[model samples]
Target chain A: MEGDAAGIMDKSINVLIVDDYRTMLRIIRNLLKQLEFENVEEATDGREALAKLRAGNFGLVISDWNMQPMTGLDLLKEVRADPRLKATPFIMVTAESKTENVIAAKQAGVSNYIVKPFNAETLREKIEKVLAHA
Target chain B: MPDGLRGRGASAAAAPPPPPSAEAIEAAVRAVLGSLEGDLTAKEAALLAELEALGRTVRRVKAEIAALGVEDITASHIPSATDELDAVVEHTAAATNEILDCCETLERLEPQLGGEGQAALRGAITRIYEACSFQDITGQRIAKVVAALKAIEARVAAVVGTVARVAPAADAGGAAASPAEAAAGARPPPTEGQALAQGPQLPGAGVSQDEIDRLLASFD
Candidate 1:
């Protein structure tokens, strides 16, 4: 548990980020790279994210809330419901910091909730908090 | 001759005065209508009621707009107008990030520069890097603006949908496909916890980040 935060910076840990915005995906990828985690994957939306999650063995999942057809909350619910992916650490990143959204994500069994416009340090802290439990 | 002249004069005098002209009649009708302005016709009455309801809706929207921290929906307040603002902000952020990347490259090449040049370059790059950090702060504020716009947009859509639904007589422009309905349909079915999803909050509007963290931590 103590070494979990340090272990997150390990180059081997595969992180998957799901967002509809290309700019956001790039920003998150850069932040993850800055933290020395290079094995990052990207998905455009929840549907794509689910497929990627099934195909890859990822250490952590970071997703945005507002999306078309399938939202991050729905994705989280699906993740929690799946037998193979139920234990995966999932972080929901969104511009919406609404109490309701946070509560919904929590009820869906999200590992962490991050408000957008956040810095890389904040991202690291959130990832560390979730990854520590893993 | 004198009898005929007298007969002609009598006949001319027997002709009565003419009725009012078309322009004078039109003026009179207009005056009557102006007087009856308060007493609308049946169709006009229905339209008036709709207009009054619309006024009320506008007032409610005005209050909502004020709540968004903007007194008026000027050209800048419109959603499309903000698209440019969003693009500019994104561009600025991208530029800032690129500058930071350049600074990183400079840091890597620092060892090759002479001692004095290295120190000078490092100072310049550090300043530039610090300046680039402004993107984070601007990004936060912009996020708030965008959130406020979304709220306004939702309220506006609801108002429009209501207006459209109310006017069944005018088939030409009914609110058949309400933006509000579309927005609602795009989301998941409401759960008890769904009510808690408030979009981006204004500063000091709700619980702090620490409180949210604690709340989530206590979930288990």
Candidate 2:
């Protein structure tokens, strides 16, 4: 158990990336890995991601703003609604660029918003910014 | 206008008649020539002075005609729209398969990730991220790739959304093929993105044997 934890601690800090696109979530996970963030998770939608968030102690939530049934904003709302996860940093990594959407996300308590098609460095920056402030 | 050639031929036939004889003709000619004589004489002198001008025109026209010599203009052909579509289709299909293959590899490795432990999980994720070209880069680079992928996605989306293109496939045999029923044809597998949404990832070392079994089973 100590060996397991030592290995785990060597690459700690769980990160959950939620996006409908598998390639994109994998990309975000990989980007986090490059930042030495080995503990990463991917959820396809808001509901499933929310379930994982409820179950795990993720340091951050990187999600797409536009999705079916439940969006990143919905997950943000859910995270904010939950008493246990309200303080958890939620950064929306998505393709939404509209002013209203940003404003709405801000209102719903989003830690940050990253317009999609971002690179590993931008992702790293956003992650660092979120974790630093968190 | 086709018959107008006769009028030109007729004028050419009457071209031999000379003026300067009959009083009426001479008077009429002299009257007009009287006013234009000075300019006419100057023109004649200039023509004599520049006799090479006509030669120059003929030479220029000959050069132009030589330059206009005909050859095969269609030798270097621009590819047809269908050819371009075929190329794009081939590329899209290959990229899709590569993406699917990467996902399958990830699934196969999930069990092994357990044997190597969490470190292996990290290693597998690392492999995936690298294979997908998702490491040590800038947002700009990722954006460029994503933009290109999105453009391609848009084209594929358009193809997928096209009722006419799909409809033609059903009618190729001259039989009415309803797309609703014709949908039974095997479509391309879901992209890696779609697979991640629904599949179990990183099952850990507990399923190492199962992972090996699955990998071995896939050989058949």
Q: What are the TM-scores, per candidate, against the unseen true structure?
A: 0.57, 0.40
Give lDDT tens digits, candidate 1, residues B1-220.
6999888878878963333332334445455445557667898777656655655665566456446644234224566757866997889877876776786788678779979999898667645543554564466567667767776766654443333322232122323334555667797686432344344566766555676688898897
Residue A74's lDDT in candidate 2: 73
Model 2 C-alpha lDDT per residue in residues A1-134, reported as the tens digit of each score: 33333343323778888876665665666566556777888898888999999888887788886554577787788899999999888887655544445556677788766654455545555556556666
Point to the candidate with the largest DockQ. Answer: 1
lDDT of each: 0.68, 0.55
What global local distance difference test value does model 1 have? 0.68
The residue pairs in collision within model 1 are A98-B198, A99-B196, A100-B196, A100-B197, A101-B196, A101-B197
Please state the Cα-based DockQ of model 2 relative to the true two-chain complex: 0.06
Error of 1 at A91 (Å): 1.7
Choose the strongest candidate by lDDT: 1
Question: Across residues A1-86, which tens digit of lDDT does each residue of candidate 1 receive?
Answer: 53567665445778999977665676677567656788999998888999999888988899987665567887888889989999
